[model samples]
Target: MPRFAANLSMLYPQHDFLDRFAAAAADGFEAVEYLFPYDYSTQELRARLSDNGLVQALFNAPPGDWAAGERGIASLPGREAEFRDGIHQALEYAAVLGNDRIHVMAGLLPDEALRGKHQAVYQENLAFAAAEAAKAGITVLIEPINTRDMPGFFLNRQDQAHAIREAVGASNLKVQFDFYHCQIVEGDVSTTLRRDFANVGHIQIASVPERHEPNLGELNYANLFNLIDSLGYSGWVGCEYRPKGDTHEGLAWLRQWKAQQA
Candidate 1:
């Protein structure tokens, strides 16, 4: 069975951010992931994970000025220093939290003409991140988010991401494949997964179009989960979806999926 990690940023919205750790654990999640851990101290976050017996599966390196709409700085020219600082900060938190993977978001790019320049910057930044992270025994990740959801997101296609990984040529740098984004950007998700499985370092799931629980989507998660298991993927599959109703009520899918494995 594929291990599932509750995405605390999207799940357990009823509780406070810090409290979501306990809620996810109570619901039988062995691991948890969130967008950023910068808001809380490492000690507080680590205590929550230790207390709940939850593994810190994944979290993002700082995205520049989230309130200012800067999704990430790695792909943005002139922000390289800030981006490097963010990576260092993220690594500090990862060390304390016992996390081995970090996702680096590609910021918005409104200018089509600047694509080449941005791609160059992104690749260079990723190379830098990978080298720094490798020293800490950590892997850096890049995710391709759908344009509809994040209109200007730099990375959008699976092939594009893999190509960037190849160009970067960093062994510890890999793709963070999200099914929701894959389905939105490229319809043939399973085929893409199979083709890009070797370069994939992490996985995530959500319903198509609505980004709800996995069971409600156009995608048949059962088959996907089985495929992942068959591929011998042992990494955590992040449940990165918002609940349509109560979070606990929406978890019937997870419960059912786990039961099937039993």
Candidate 2:
């Protein structure tokens, strides 16, 4: 069976950020992830994980000026220094948290006409981040986000992420496969996983169209989980969804899914 991680940022909005750690543990999640951990001290975050017996699975590097609508600095031509600084911060946190992977978000292109230039910058930034992370035994992940959720997200397709990873040539560089996004951008989740499973660093899931619990979606997560196991994927599958109701109440799928896996 695949190990699961609750996305604290999206999963436990009912509780304060720091308190979500215990809530996830109480509900049976052995691992957890979130958007960014910069707001909290590493010591405090580490204490929460230790107290809850939870493993820090993954987190994204700093996305510049989140309130200013800048999703990430990476891939932005003039923000290379800021991007690198964010990478260093991410690595520092991961080291303290014992996390093994970090997603490098490619910032949105200011204009479609700048695709070529932005692509080059993204590749370079990923290469730099991957190489730096490799020294610490950490994998750097790139995810393909659907434009509907993030309208101008620079990386919007599985092929695009794969190509960038290939061009970067960093052994530790890998794709963060999110089924919800894939279903929106490209419908062949299983086929794509089969072909690129070796290069995948992490996987995430949420219901498509509505982005809710897996049981409420068009995708058959039960089968998909089985396929992932059959494909020999041992990485964490993050529950990156917004609950339609109480977060704990919405976890029936996870509970039932675990029963089925058993």
Model 2 misplacement above 4 A: none
Query: Alpha-carbon error at 89 in model 2, in Å?
Result: 0.8
List model 1 lDDT by residue over 1-262, tens digit each: 9999999999989899999999999899999999999999999999999999999999999999999888988999999999999999999999999999999999999798999999999999999999999999999999999999888899999999999999999999999889999999999999999999999999999999899999996999899999999999999999999999999999999899888789
Candidate 1 residues lying further than 4 Å off, grouped into runs, are none
Residue 146 of candidate 1: its Cα lDDT? Answer: 92
lDDT of 1: 0.95
lDDT of each: 0.95, 0.94
Tell me the tens digit of each residue's lDDT in model 2 across 1-262.
9899999999889799999999999999999999999999999999999999999999999999999999887889989998999999999999999999999899888899999999888988998999899999999999999999999999988888899999999999999999999999999899998889899999999998899999987999888988999999888999999999999999999899888767
Clashing pairs counted in every model:
0, 0
TM-score of 2: 0.99
Estimated TM-score per prediction? 0.99, 0.99
